[model samples]
Target chain A: MSTDTAEKYHKHTPAPIDCNNVVISLRNIRKSFGSLEVLKGVDLDVCKGENVVVLGRSGSGKSVLIKIIAALLRPDEGTVRVLGKEIDQLDARELQELRSKIGFSFQGSALYDGMTVRANLEFPLVRNQRKLTRQEVDKAIRQVLDDVGLSRTIDQMPAELSGGQKKRIGIARTLILHPEIMLYDEPTAGLDPVTSVEINDLINDVQQRYNTSAVIITHDLTCAKATGERLVILSEGKFLRQGSFEEVFHNDDPIIKDFYNYNFISDS
Target chain B: MKVFFLRIYDIYQFSLRFWKEAFLPPYEYKEVFNQFFEVGIKSLSIISLTGFITGLVFTKQSRSSLAEFGATSWLPSLMAIALLRALAPLVTALIIAGKVGSNIGAEIGSMRVTEQIEAMEVSSTNPFKFLVVSRVLATTCIVPVLAIYMGFIGLLGAFVNVYNNEQTSFVSFFQEAFMKITFLDLFTLVLKSAIYGYTIGMAGCFNGYYADQGTVGVGRAANTAVVVSMFLIFIEEMLIVTLINTYR
Candidate 1:
């Protein structure tokens, strides 16, 4: 049964948060699966053009938080608002329209396996963007391919691409929509260190080039350090800390320090 | 009994969701056509082959029974009625339930495990339209046509049986067979096949879309899809026969 706690406001926030200019807002967000509570009264606010990286060990509900932001999963309690609109209030059409302005990039790229790279890039535009002419569709496809530096592989099927190439195409598919908010789930996961750095750098480039605000959930410190200006370490279902990268990186908290040190928890 | 009732209620809700989403705007026309080709044209050869074998076996078996009463001349009329009104349609639907049902279930279940379906939803694409609706509508439209094709091919198989018995003329055999058949028989034939089509489509997608287990879960979905759809086809045929018997 759903708890119907969607209207509950934050009761134990450490400090008052400024909500003005916030693109994504979660107030007392709580989610549980059976007996295990993955998120317990989590609160966060991401503003325009800001990149907030959520750091966590495996199974810390980092991915769940990102899914909730997209309204893909509803919280058992508390309110979620994306782009200033309450997620629970939007109708199906309104939700789709809202989603068009936001992009979600999954770790495996989640590219449609049956589609070629050209078709994968064309999917969102063909599905949602009705005003784009043929020329515009081609232009958008070419631009995003160029942005991801995968223009040569446009005609290649997703199966033909390498792990890093798939992730790049995954990001590029999201970028083609020119989303105002990008929700990335472990963009650098399952890649070599050099490729991981390349992807992290590419994410920074997309932020500048597309002027989009982003929420990245990762356990990799190198990925977090490279892409995140501000960082929030999630542990035991609460925000352990949130501040500029240097502020969280150098803090003396043992738990926060462990999150940084044990970044490869999921590697095994 | 309790678990069975619960399953029935769950399927009812699942079917209701499909109907509600089906009527919504932003339908995927291209995807629907693609599904038609996948469900219809791809299924023809197998359906035809099955239909032919079924007609030959049933006609040969029935001839031996009629010979006991020296009523062998009634063979063509009886063969046509049985094949057209029941056997061909039901058998064709059962085959489709096996082939198409398992396919939809496995495909969607794999997509679920891979998070492709979740990705589609997050990207604001109505996967219900692109995946479920296209496939369901294709089956609904195509299965009835396949059933009709099965009936026609089975008649040819019966003609071969009649030739073995010295009836010898194709034209005379077809004329005699169709003479006793009524429009009501044909109507019920089409109606039953369409219902069977709808059942397979719904059962396949319902099992697949809700599959939560990993790879093993996908296998369970495919298995359950074929089993449930085949059972539904039998239930529908029984209902159709009862209705026809009651009114006619």
Candidate 2:
């Protein structure tokens, strides 16, 4: 293939790897603190190029499940595999190597207050791939900044930006690594409706552009509707329901229906 | 009391895990270096500036008392020995433990409370390695450097005081100080200062790493770490004095 064609394919149409290419899989995962069982045998899967949304009320182990998948929290029992590598079995070095392929957008934006937006974007980039020439780093910065539509504010300190701009910068920083999978924890939590939609659309655009899988943890049904192809709901550390958006909306369970209807109007 | 014991256990376990994670690597050198810059180098000016003023003030105070005893000539040597042997390192470390310790505690505590540390974990980054190790290592290595720097500046301040107060020439003042100052005493001073640095840095970073209850918790950690480290430095200095007296 010509370089241009390869670049085009890389950006637009990645040769389908596998429709069921499970990017992340969790089986019989359990987590606890002292006597509190946080995640009770939670099982989940995100296929290649799928957007999986997890919904739950506060304290519902939705965030915990995502943490397990990302290898942030170790399960007291069971297995978590990402890209076919068992995460829990890997040592810290191996784990960091594995995490290089994953990008996480924090719920709070988590931009280092001491650093500017540009420096934050450059952080993982410089660490993971050290040989990128200065020009390449700058170009990568511009590209990711452009991707998140915050190129104009690249030099601004994180504190100088508005709430939505900070989120955009956070997303932009996550994109720098070109992760195979992107995990978002309450990406739209504190934003106004308009900015929330913009962030949701940005997540969608990233998925389509990179053919990346996503697992978004949120309580906002609107976010679930906009980003996830499949919706999974949790309660008391167990998977309460899981299906495609249509299957989930028409679910016989009143709890699921109530959640689906509640988000449908507010988001639309 | 049980809760108190549990908190101590929590801190001990955190330090243990931090060391294990930090040593096993794909080490985050950039983060460590960045923290070193923040915790060590950035805090240097205040420590040095304060040490200089402290030495000058001590000399001025000591001169008046010693003058009544007809021992005014001992001022330069006394100031040098006190600043070099004890005061500079102890004061700088207390200040550092207060300023940098609280800052790290707050930074890491907020990261924990906000789930930024969790975000790092899920991104496959070892939060301990990236956050805790880098911070501890930076403080361990950088605080010593700061101690040495502060000690030198404090000595210069003493020299300035002697030059102004007793109308002594720099050469005569230093000659007198050298006659009184032993190699063992200088060595002990450097050793104590380095120990003080390590103690302050480790305590501050450790408190921050395991901070609980959000911002209030971070504030408490920072405050407690400084106070505890300051107390420990004095106790350790006394213990060292006892050891040196017994051993020598």
- Fnat of candidate 2 is 0.59
lDDT of 2 by residue, A69-146 (tens): 877778999999999999867886788788888888888888877777788888778777879999999999999999
Q: For model 2, what is the error of residue B42's alpha carbon versus the real structure, in angstroms, after optimal superposition? A: 4.5
| B34-126 per-residue lDDT for model 1 (tens digits) | 888888889999988888888888889998899999987888899889988988788888888899999999998888888889888877788
Q: What is residue B194's positional error in candidate 2, in angstroms?
A: 1.4
| Clashing residue pairs for model 1 | none
Measured against the true chain A, the candidates' chain A TM-scores are: 0.89, 0.90
* Distance from true location, Cα of B88 in model 1, Å: 1.3
Report model 2's TM-score to 2 decimal places.
Answer: 0.87
The pairs that clash in candidate 2 are none
- Evaluated on chain B only, what are the TM-scores of all the candidate structures, in order? 0.94, 0.87
The DockQ values of the predictions, listed in order, are: 0.69, 0.50
